[model samples]
Target: MCPPEHFEVSYSINPWMEPDKPTDAPLALVQWDRLRARLVSLGHRVDVVPPRPGLPDMVFAANAATVIDGRVLAARYRHPQRSGEEPAYQAWFAEHGYPVRQAGFVNEGEGDMLPTGARILAGTGFRTDHRAHAEAADHFGLPVVTLHLVDPYFYHLDTALAVLDHEEIMYYPGAFSPDSQALLRELYPDAILADEADAAVFGLNAISDGEHVLLPQSAVHLTESLRAAGFTPIAVDLSELLKAGGAAKCCALELRESLPSTERRREPS
Candidate 1:
C-alpha cells in the first residue's frame, strides 16, 4: 500500500472524483494509516511504496500491477493522469526481486484484473482494454473470464465485485452488463448480492483473507450479508479516501505467490 501523503482530488479521472470539492489530505492519511494498522492486526504483512509528487492517485496502489505466482504484470494506465504511476510501481516490484512484465495493452493492473482460485475475473468497458484479457491469460497461464462493467460509478471490477474466498464472491449485479451479470450468476449461484445502497458506498470494494473481510463501515446491509454467509466482516472508515474513488481494496494490492500444493491461492487480506 502507498501512503496518501500527496493524495487529493486535484483531477477527475473517475465518477467519484470531484476536483471542486474540498479534500482533507491529512484526514486521508489518518484513515489510510488506520486501514494499514487494521490489516496488520489481522495477521497480514503490509508493504509500503514511497509516494511521489505529481502522482496523487499513487495512493491507490492496487492500480499499479497484478502479481500472480511471483510474476508482476505492470499496468499501462488509460488516463494520462495515472500513467505516471506505472514506472514507480514497476521500479518497486523490480527492486523487490519480482519479475516484472510490462503490459502490451492498456490495463489498470489489479483495478481491472482480479484473480479467483480457478481463473481470472477480468473487467473491461472502462479503464482496461478488452485485448488485455488475453495478455493476462498468457502471462499468468490461467483462464480469463471477461466481465463488462456498465455503470460508470463502478468503473473498476473491484468497485462492484469482491472475491470472498476461493470460489465465492459478492457483487452488485446492477453495475455489470446483463451478459456479464448472467455469467457471474452462472459462475457463482450462491454469491452474495448487494443492494444499491451498500454498493453506492463502495461496499463491494473489499478484501478478504478467506475468513475475515475488511470493508467500509457505511455498508450496513452488506456487513450483515457477510455475517450471514459465515464470514467475519471488519468495518473501517475510509470516507476521506472515498472522495478519490478508493477504499480498502483500492489502497491495497495483493502480491500472490504460487505454492507447491496449489497453482495459485486467493488474494491476501
Candidate 2:
C-alpha cells in the first residue's frame, strides 16, 4: 500500500528559553494560521501537534533537524541549552515511528542542511559540525560541500544560502568560503544573489516546493523577480515570529519521505 499522504508535525508551546524574550501573540498566531492555510491550498495534508510544554521558544520552528529517505537525523542545536531539544525530538520520533539518526557533534538543526540538488552544502561552525556532514553524506548518498563558517550572526546555513529552484540558488558572497563561492558561480551563473538586508529578515529561508517559491511579503522586489522567473510566488507575513528571531519563510517545514514506501512524516532526522 502507498504510505499516508498526510504529514504529522509537532510544535512546542513552551520552550526552556529566555522568558524575557518578547513574543507578539497576535502576530505569531496569524503567521501560523497563514501557514496552515497555504499548505491546505497547495493540497498538503497537515497534522499539527501542540508545542511541547516548556519549549515555548519552539516557535522558532526551524530548530528541527533535516531528514531524507526515512532517516530521521536529530538536530544538535548550537546553543548549549538548545542541545536539550534533541532528546525530546528523539523521543517524539521513537513514539511516532520515524527512524533515528544524529548529526555529527557540535551541530544544531536543519537550518544547516542546505540542499543543492543532490549535493549537501552542510555548514560547519555554530549550528552544525563537520562530522555530521560526513555522516549525513554516508546515510543519504550525496556529496557534501563543507562550509567553515566565520560569522556568528549567520550561524545557520539557511540564513546565508538557499536553493531557489532545481538549478538555481540564492546566496550571499560574504557568507561563503572562496572555494564554495567559486563552485557556485561555476554551477549556476544565473542564480540570484539574495539581498543581505532581506536575508537578515530570514527571507532566504524560502520554501521551494520543487516548483513555486513561498516567499515573504516584506521582500517586494525579490518577490517580483521570483514571479518574473515563472515561479508562483506565495507571500506570507511573519513579523511577529521575527521578534524572536524567526521569519515567515523559516516558520514552516519541509517533510521528506522514505523511498519505495514513500510515505510523508512530520518528525525530523
Candidate 3:
C-alpha cells in the first residue's frame, strides 16, 4: 500500500471527488496508517511503496496492477490524471522481480478486474474497456466473466462488489446492469446482498481473507450480515479516504503467488 502523504481532492475524477470541499490530508494519512496497522495485526505483511509528488491518487495502490501467480499485468489508466502512476507501479513490480506486462488496452488494474479462484470477474462501462477482459484472460490463462456497471457512483467493480473467497462474494445489486445482476445471481446464488444505505457508504469495498472481513465502520448492516455468515468483521474508520472514493480495499492490493508451505505458514508481525 502507498502512503496518503500526497492525497487530496484537487480534481474531480469520480462522483465522490468534490474538489471544492475541504479535505484533511493529515487525517487521511492517520487513517491510512491505522488501516496498515490493522492489517499487520491480522498477521498480514504490509508492503509500502514510496509516494511520489503530483500523484495524489497513488494512495489507491490497488489500481496499480493485477498480480496472479507471480505475473503482473500493469494498469493502463483511462484518465490522464492517473496515467503517471502506471510507470511507478510497473517499475516497482519489475524491481521486485515480478514479470510485468504492460496492458494493451485501458484497464484500471484491480479496480476493474477481480480475480477469484476459478476465473476473473471483470467490470466495464466506466473506466475499464471491455476488450481488456480478453487481454486479461489470455494473460492469466483464466476465464474472464464480464460484468457491466450502470451506476456512476460505483464506477469501479471493487466499489460495488468484493470477493469473499473462492466460491463466495458480496455486492450491491443496484450498481450493476440488469443482465450483470442476473449473471451474478446465477453464478453466486448465496452471495450476501448489501442494501442501498450500506452501499452508499462504500460497504462493498471490503477485503476478506476467507475468515476475516475488513470494511468501513459506517456499514452497520453489512457488519451484522458478515457475522451471520460466520465471518469476522473488522470495522475501521476510513471516512477521510472515502472523500476521494476509496477505503481499505482501494489502498491495498493482493499479490498472489505460489509459496513454500513453511513460508506460507509463517505469520507476519
Q: Against the true structure, what is each candidate's TM-score?
A: 0.96, 0.80, 0.95
Pick out the ten consecutive residues of candidate 3 with the lowest summed lDDT.
259-268
How do these models rank on lDDT, best leading?
1, 3, 2
lDDT of 3: 0.91
Please provide, for model 3 over 128-176, each residue's C-alpha lDDT reduced to its tens digit, 9 standing for 90 to 100.
9999999999999989999999999999999999987776789999999
Model 1 per-residue lDDT tens digits across residues 184-237: 999999999999999999999998887889999999999998888788899999
Sorting all predicted structures by TM-score, with the top scorer first, yields: 1, 3, 2
Residue 208 displacement (Å), model 3:
1.0
**Which scores higher on lDDT, 1 or 2?**
1
**Model 3 collision count:** 0
Instruction: Specify the poorest-scoring 10-residue window by lDDT in model 1.
Output: 259-268
Q: Cα deviation in Å at residue 143, candidate 2?
A: 0.9
RMSD of each: 3.0, 7.6, 3.8
